[model samples]
Target: MPTPSKISVVTERGQVSIPAQLRKELSLEKGQQLLWEKTGEHEIRVTVLPERKPRGAMAMLGFAKRFRQTRRTEDWMAELREGEK
Candidate 1:
């Protein structure tokens, strides 16, 4: 995949405007949170993350629990051993 060459956003009252092309490509929507990092002089990185749902971590734990409940421990152990080869 080709990375975007250059992008610019206007700074207003200490807030920056994210470009529409980058926003759409990253699936960003209004009121979404973004993470920013400074790499070096005149360089910065921005990334868009999916919106987090309430109790999302609990839901993931539940998924793991249900999956483990349906699997035999011995079978899982065997698979793990095979993966070590």
Candidate 2:
């Protein structure tokens, strides 16, 4: 198969819209991220990073789901106080 190439002009705000055909071919989306790297004096590499889900307050979801807690937070503090004696 042949590679498709095209030219685009950067807007006044330094933003360039990805060509519609390339976007569709690459499955690019509105909120997706693209990493730009300069490989040479005039060459810039565009890398498509994997999609990420922002966890926010639920960052610990599915983490340590099976870990058993041996003691409560208060119980641990009490043990530390006694060990100082």
Candidate 3:
């Protein structure tokens, strides 16, 4: 695919604004996180980092509700090996 480029101006505090076209193409929203790296002397790479979210107490419950403790680890392994034979 052909890549599009746009000129950006860096602010006084070493900040650069991503253009609207690039933002729209990247589906960037307000308060999103970005990872930037200086790859070489004159080149930099940008990666989209996952958004940080605080998990509430309710969000932590019941994911593995069916989990149960086995009596022994060796028994579990034996059971798995039995199926292979």
Best candidate, TM-score:
2
Residue 23, candidate 3: C-alpha displacement in angstroms = 0.5
- Clashing residue pair totals per candidate (backbone < 3 A): 0, 0, 0
**Number of the predicted model whose lDDT against the real structure is largest:** 2
Cα displacement (angstroms), candidate 3, residue 13, comes to 1.9
Of the pair 1 and 2, which is ahead by lDDT? 2
Question: Where does the lowest 10-residue lDDT sum fall in candidate 1?
Answer: 60-69
Error of 1 at 49 (Å): 2.2
- lDDT digits (tens) for residues 6-74 of candidate 1: 556656666787767777777787889888999999888877767887685665655756555576889
Q: Estimate the overall C-alpha local distance difference test score of candidate 2.
A: 0.88
Q: 1-85, model 3: which lDDT tens digit per residue?
A: 6557888888999989998878888899998989999999988899988877557975668756668664698898999999999
TM-score of each: 0.52, 0.61, 0.59
Q: Please state the error at residue 5 of candidate 1 in Å.
A: 3.0
By the lDDT metric, which is better: model 1 or model 3?
3
lDDT of each: 0.76, 0.88, 0.84
Candidate 2 lDDT by residue in tens digits, 1-85: 6558889899999998888988988899888999999999999999999988768867777767669677899999999999999
Residue 37's lDDT in candidate 3: 97
